[model samples]
Target: MWTTLFLSYSPIPEYEYVENSIPTFVAIGGFPFIAFHYPSPPMGSDVVSQSMWPLFYLNEFFWLIIGTILTKLLPQKIKNYSQIRLFCIVMTLIISLSGLGYLVLRFD
Candidate 1:
């Protein structure tokens, strides 16, 4: 599952901390560090960490619904402009909000 996510997110830039060193993928209690050479990350890991799960869930939920309806209900030749627009808008908002949540949680 996470591998799919990583592949899907391949367009993102490769940061040295996330790339070179052993990135802590999941942390139980303390702040989870992604950068290299870090055991327990600084305080406040839960802030962005928690937000990401919900955003990912929401995005999946919306995408599943949209994708299912498009595949099942739509005709082969016709395109649903409204649904496509809606999906795109929601996805963009989801990405933007998640990024914002990450910054706020990680830094502030």
Candidate 2:
């Protein structure tokens, strides 16, 4: 999923870290880290998972705070109109395709 998100993003040079790393980390948390909240990640995972749950949400809260600050301070984040349009187009296409693919997989 992160790979697909990256394909949609396709960051330009100046804002690469802001574009790539943030979403990647978010995706990692959304998927792998989230598994810890489920039944069990491993045989002995209960203790570890319980201990880590609060920290996960705390990390996400901090990330949101940082992102809010960055957006306020970095108004020129996108650099140009073309890059913005490209990002929108690519993300729209990827999301649409992914939704259709998911529906197909689910029903078929």
Give the per-residue lDDT digits (tens) of candidate 1, residues 1-108: 222233343222236346556545323211121221112345444444454565556555665676798889767674788898899799888876775564454433
The C-alpha local distance difference test score for the whole of candidate 2 amounts to: 0.43
Candidate 2, residue 33: the lDDT equals 32
**Candidate 2: lDDT of 10?**
22
Task: List ranges where model 2 is wrong by over 4 Å.
Answer: 1-48, 76-108
Question: Candidate 2 on 1-108: residue-level lDDT in tens?
Answer: 333322332222444347433322111223223322222112222233445456546645665677689868976756588988999799979976884453233223
What TM-score do all the candidates reach, one by one?
A: 0.30, 0.30
Candidates' C-alpha lDDT: 0.46, 0.43
Give candidate 2's error at residue 21 in angstroms. Answer: 38
